[model samples]
Target: MCGIIGVFGNDNAGRLAAVGLFAEQHRGQESCGMAVSDGLLIRLHKKMGLVKEVFHEEQLNALPGKIAIGHVRYPTKGSATEFNTQPHLVETLSGPCYALASNGDIVNYAQVRKMLENEKVYFKSDNDAELLVKYIAYRILHYKENIGDAIRNLMRDIKGAYSSVLCTPTELYMFRDPYSIRPMIWGKTPEGTVIVASESCALDTLGVQDRKEVPPAGIIKVSDSKIEVLDNDPNLYREGNCEKHCIFEQIYFSRPDSFHFGENVYAVREKIGAALALQDEGLNPDLVVPVPDSSNFIGLGYANQNGIPLSLGLIRNHYIGRTFIKPEQAVRDESVRQKFNVLPNFFNGKRIVLIDDSIVRGTTIRKIVRLIKDAGAAEIHLRIGSPQIKHSCYYGIDTPTTEELIANRRTLEEIREITGVDSLKHLPLTDLKTCVHCPENYCYACFDGNYPVGVPDVYN
Candidate 1:
């Protein structure tokens, strides 16, 4: 997943963009970039690092414009390198246009790239962002009378989840894939300054009023004085037929303070905790302990509603990098220990209820359980905030194949035994809707095997 933001108005465009990106830093930490349009030229600054590390005050002050776009990217499908960083500016025949950023994966990237390559369209890198830019540029070459018509035609050629922000000198535009697998929200300051971001938290940081979500398979265009909704396909509004919004957004991806589709993320997590408590009514643990970071909200909710004490029995090392060590089995085992330290005083001699988001391959959960067990916990109850992940995610998440998912082959009881936990509870797939407050809008394809977008035959 990635985070994107675009702002129109205000001379300190780069600084505003940086502020928005900093608010969205949790979405992506690998790379950060910002591009500013001064009506005459587009000035760009991007690098492979955290927001604070990449954009210094001098750099932000140097890019002068009243309009800007920014991005913070996490490498899911492409190699993590400076070349792949976004806010990619393309000089198309329809004048210079900037494809700021997008937050979802394109499953048909390989096919699309191959088709473009067959026509001798040489590319600078293997990143999907560049491919998307080329596709948009190509379409604009044919349909330049109206930008909306060009984008509509381009959408028909690609298949996958995409929530994007594109900007020109005169306007800022937001596009959501038909399925809305990723989150995108727009808001305006009291002074009428327009802002679009991957999450509402960014707008909150900028003190902007919360606007409605960019509808699925919809486009919103903002100019100096007007905002227009370009509905390329109205059929997507059909109830129960809209594409699924990624479920992971609520579980681990989104900021706890943000809201998506009118549902507050923190509240949804609390609901998940309540569901877990109800599902495993028999496990009367002495304390509810969160795994830290992601699961803290849900753990608190569970403890509050179940009348169990909530304790921070585990502490996470905030400095751990995504690729700190190699992906080798031995290295993976060692990293888990280094990443988390159990508070022996709190966990010892206590029946603990451990809450986590989801178990991908069960390796990390097993290691965490063993760590807690070694700390002298009398009994351990595993509570997952979401349903079992039985299928792979094609829309940007780095999940393994079905054969590798533990839930695909083993039952909950078997998993409990494998992890050495006294009891285990997972939220049911049916309860996911209730947790998110959108029974029909959110996507649970990862748990139910129903993909909103077509899965490609091959992926990188």
Candidate 2:
């Protein structure tokens, strides 16, 4: 739901962090920020906007350091406010020093925050990133534990998905939760500058190759000379108590070029499209069109495998951000207006197969189908690349109620009628598992109600 990156051993660490944040802008759009550490001090800059809008050349130049961490914000946990923007700073009397940015929702946040409050810890914002920073500072400054021991304890205590990168005045540290519900990869540039980001695409933008994921429950410390593996503990993961890697990351959240959880994101999506195509071979469609950005490669795979000609029947406005992540339904519907347009000739008088990632609330897709129909398409066959989402997501995603999910409330036939499509087919749960690299480890809680870490009592 958010993007995080840290740059170490580079003089233009702030600029590199800015560039990395721009590459990861898709992961979050509500806000963006960067924290730079020059070993003596940490300079922080954050605001509410896209990456380019938030930071300018003058601001980036002012934040000079050898190390920096950046974040793009999507409101998975905190309210939409400038006060909640990250990387949340932890300051001593000296200056704003330790900086932390993390990518997942903490399920036990309320309990932890309450405990911290009872212990006289004052909180400035409702953001869980702030809690994480305070918790780490508490462990290091209060309990007198080293960074490695503090992080290990954090893994044991924090009971949810969090892949985090932190910048101390002295060192750069990155770690994943015991479950590894989000993605983190690190690579070193030819100049020996090490980079840790939420996705490989961030590194690719920086011209850094030879990337590798920080394994589940793994801690990585990047220094000038070498990268150290802090904690290799696998007690929870080996026993299968917390082995659920996020399936939605491959299905929707990640960029196609980025690799995560032992699979190429694009290849996995392509395989999913091919599998969906196989489910309806007898059906014929004159043209195959993807629902713009998210389903592009999936449509390519379907068109290539089924020998159906692919065309861009719908043109997406790159100026618009993702609508589904918007806070309200009215806002999302209004966003859909500017986000897509029908190409004149492609949708008229043709049997079109519309490929899309998934149908959540069915509001956006319904509007898109109306556009295609208005463009004079003779028939619309909507093929979704993922299984029906029958439940809601609690870990970092916005949907948290079953009532908000369309597939949970309506039958397939009813849904097809509602969308006004000639035919509708969602990729089956079984096929979806087979399409991924590690089928067994995926968390299909939203599709099948098989909550890996168990849904909170509040949702129930």
Candidate 3:
């Protein structure tokens, strides 16, 4: 739901972080910020806007240091406010100043916040990212725990998905939750710069090839000398760790070219499309058309398997962000037309198989169907790459209320009737499991209502 990156040991750390963040601008657009460490102080510059809007030559120069971390915010868990923007600078009295940038949401927010507050640990923001920074800082500053112990303890105590990067005045630290429900990868450049990001696309932006991922319940440290794990223990993260990485990230959140969790995101989506096509063997349509951008790869696989021509029937605006993940339905509706355009001539009189990632509230799809049908398409056979999302996700994605989820309350026929699609079929559970290959390593709460971790009271 958010994009975070850390650049260490680079002379142009601020600039590099900016480029990495720009690569992941799709991850978040509500707000952004960057923090750089100048050895004595953590110079901070963050605001309620896009990365490009918040940082420029002047802003980057103002915050200069050997270590820099950046964040793009979609705010799945937090409200839209400048106060909740990251990278959050944590000023600890007992230790050196550091900043925190995190992806994913914390499920045990209420308990953790109350515990920290009862200890008189003052907080500046109401967001979950701030809780993580304060928790680690509390351990290091008050308990005199080492950085490794702080991270290790955090993994043991925290109860939700978090793939995060932290930067001190002297070193950069990165870690993932025990479940590894979010994506975080580490790469290094020939120039001796170390980079950690929410996805490998950011590393591609930095031209780094020598890469490795931080394992579930894993931690990485980068200093002037070298980048290494804080603990050399061969058995901790290796022996028995339950790694239920969010499969949705591979299906939608990540860029198609990005490699995450040891698998190419685009490749997995293509396989999902192939599976969907195998299930939809008997149906015949004139051509396959994608909703644009995120679902393009899935449509390619579907079209390739079905022996139907694939066309860019819907031309997506490269300038706008994704509409489904945008916060409000009013904003989504107003932005939907601006985001996509149906090629009237191309789709004229064609029986089109329209492929999209998944349906959330059914608002976007209803509008899309109306657009294509109004443009002269005779029929729209809507094929979703994933199964119906019936449960709200607590681990970063913002579908928290069941009432807002169309599939949770409506039957398949009702959904089809509501969208006015001639026919609609979602990727079956069996087909989805086949494509993912490891159903056990995924939190399928949104599809099957099987929460890997206990749900928060808010969701209940």
Residue-level lDDT for 340 in candidate 3 = 77
Give TM per candidate.
Answer: 0.92, 0.97, 0.97
Residue-wise C-alpha lDDT for candidate 3, range 1-460, written one tens digit per residue:
8999999988789999999999999899999989998777899888888788888888888887889998999877778788898888888665698789999898888888899999998887888889998899999888889888988877766678888999899999998887788999988899889999998999998989899888877788888877778653423532244578888998898999999777889989899888878877888899999888889999999999989999988988888877877888898898887877887587788999999999999988898899998899988999999999998888888787888899978999999999999999999877787776576777778998877766874555
Q: What tens digits encode model 2's per-residue C-alpha lDDT throughout 1-460? A: 8999999998999899899999988899999988898888888889999999888998887998999999998887878788888999888663336799999888778888888889888899988889888888878777878778878877777677788999888789998887788889998899888999999999999988788988888999877667899756757533475467888888788999998888999998888889889987888889899998879888988998899998988999887888877878898999999899998766668999999999999988999999999999999999999988888777778786788889889999999999999999999999898887678877888888877666654454
- Of the candidates numbered 1 and 3, which has the greater lDDT value? 3
Candidate 1, residue 386: how far the Cα is off, in Å: 1.5
Better of 1 and 2 by lDDT: 2
- The per-candidate count of clashes, in order, stands at 1, 0, 0
Model 1 residue 157 CA deviation in Å: 1.5
| Model 3 lDDT-worst window of ten | 232-241
Residue 254, model 2: lDDT of 91
Off by over 4 Å in 1: 234-240, 321-335, 409-414
lDDT of 1 by residue, 209-252 (tens): 84878887788888777889986773543235655778788888
Q: Which residue runs of candidate 2 sit more than 4 Å off their true CA positions?
A: 93-96, 237-242, 457-460
Model 3 scores a TM of 0.97
